[model samples]
Target: MRHLKGGPEPDKHMLRRELLAVRNGLTTDDVREAATGLAQHALQLPELAHARTVAAYVSVGSEPGTLALLDALRERGVRVLLPALLPDNDLDWGAYAGEGSLARIQHGGRMALFEPVGERLGPDAVTDADVVLLPGLAVDARGMRLGRGGGSYDRVLARLERAGARPTLVVLLYDAEVVERVPEEAHDRPVHAVVTPSGVRRFS
Candidate 1:
């Protein structure tokens, strides 16, 4: 397994395009089945199963669907927090009451996102979570995640670090997305695990 300290960081732009192409090829049924499997696998994690507050996201496009997992957590009486993208790319969190609690909002030219319609819980709300479900394009052997380059989660991680929060960080992906390597930067922190349709893999 290649580590960031030993290998050159691969070209992230090319990797993003390549991964997007693969995801784009997935049909609606493929995405639906994957979502079901992913939810089952993720729910088995000890960290998630025991979590009281979980910070997660609503999946868009061909991304690994998260609605099933989010709904399941809510059904378990766990407080699920979803992100609301701020103007500066920072995230403000809100509780996930249910599918009906979300409203579609178009942020500038970006795709419309389904966000909570309740009161904004403020950015620090994430620090209270026991688990955080991160959205990513891929994860390497070392658990370093390749995000969409939006820098939203970066700020979230940095905030967690600053606040001395040590929540269990998890990424949702398809089985193929867990590769032997992904470009790692200085700010890239290894995740605790990656949950996929096939199963789960953990890292130190």
Candidate 2:
């Protein structure tokens, strides 16, 4: 996708309205079923299937399915790393060996996360990553991501750009969460592809 330095500021009110519309449209059972199907497709992706190391997020909110995918990756012998929210609102990645191995760490406000194992690293870790599954509030066909207004992934992905490496960025979303356009900002990062229960699609 062509990189644009700045675009119209996303209409926060409109965005919220759109998000609520999507949220209200789906039942909890619908989300679970979609997530399960998406997880299966993710495991079948050639890159992910053969990847030695992968970077993923621990799902929060009403995003798509991830727990099963994490387990599947582990079963395939892929080294999985999860992002832990840090004190400064930056992200640090660590290995997700298992639930028993994860320690509770403070995250985004009062939220607690299972801290991954080993030394914390930045997005340069994406250099060796075969796959990086991103969490998004919504994603458009152009790969634009509407995050939770945190700008955490944007900052990290920009750092990756400075290092001259672009790992495959995949956004995991429920089918309905995929939209025609998600408002973008000057600092927003674009993903390479989006995966849903139906299948994977190149965003650009």
Candidate 3:
């Protein structure tokens, strides 16, 4: 991927900080309303509407909420997969039965994450998903996602590639998180689309 910034470009760390700061300011009501809109708009995507299995994550802190989407998908009889963080920051998959199926986990000093409490499906299980909903701070015009710098989903994407799996990659975010550009690395892969509270944007 090309580093396509115009002027004095900010690195991923700086961009993340700015984005996170804005998110940290959102109120509980703001997050709740956005979560509802996110689920409604995301459910309209043909990729997700027809998918039998979807690999998604639970939202934490001020990140765009995904619980609404997850519950909606489950109610549709879709087999939802959630990730369990491995010791190395790589993700392992598990089925999402419901809200009760998740357990809170604090990865050392990192923020607490709501992860699946079911049987571990191993890292490669993501290859079986028809759609993979990624969590990100922002998605640029190129559909390139700016993750939280954990590199966990990076490993998941690589594993899917090695298995020759072609799942529709989607990221859920707030309307403001859709930006003109975001910093990208050589290993970065653009997502197929991003579903925000406003609507969906696709990339070629």
Candidate 4:
């Protein structure tokens, strides 16, 4: 696969639109097949194997599916923490009890999200996680991730850093989403690995 070269720079907004179009184009069968494969590959990660607590999210729209992995982790007795979006776009933590424990929430004009309906554990709760499964549009060879522009995960990363948390950071995406490079800014940091339906890639 051709990696992106550092030069005049690519338009992130345009790139996002293009990627989203591809994602939205996936058929229901395509998404389900990928989701099953994604769960298989993600569960093989050594980080997850040793993790007692994992911070993850529920997939919405065409995002790479995570429900299978979440259920598997929960069944293993691992503490699975889900996020609830704050008005400021930051996140608060909540424990995932099961499918019955989630509540659909509509934040303004955004699509409804399935959030945990348990006690609000506050933002700092994520610091206790051993692994954090991030949601993104793409990740470059350098492991720098391109998010959906909401900036919620950015704050989460910052909080983890401030607390000196060394949780293994992982992003979930389609195989095509792993590119040679993507646009970057000062605050951007590389993820430790990415899990696709095809397999997993790790970075130093």
Best by the lDDT measure: 4
RMSD of each: 2.8, 4.6, 2.9, 1.6
Candidate 3, poorest ten consecutive residues by summed lDDT: 1-10
The residue-level lDDT of candidate 1 at 9 comes to 59
lDDT of 4: 0.93
lDDT of each: 0.92, 0.74, 0.90, 0.93
Per-model TM values vs. the true structure:
0.95, 0.83, 0.95, 0.96
lDDT by residue (tens digit), candidate 2, 13-34: 5775667677667777877897
Query: Could you tell me the lDDT of residue 163 within candidate 3?
Result: 98
Error of 2 at 169 (Å): 0.5
Model 2 vs truth, CA RMSD = 4.6
1-204: candidate 3 lDDT, tens digit per residue: 122344444588888888899899999999999999999999999998899999999999888899999999999999999999999999998999999999999989989999998899999999999999999988888898999998999999999999999999999988878877888899999999998888888999
Question: Model 4 clash pairs?
Answer: 3-180
Supply candidate 3's per-residue lDDT for 99. Answer: 97
* Candidate 3: C-alpha RMSD after superposition: 2.9
lDDT score of residue 202 within candidate 3: 92
Winner by TM-score = 4
Task: Write one digit per residue (lDDT tens) for candidate 4, span 88-166.
Answer: 9999999999989999999999889999999999999999999999999999988999999999999999999999999
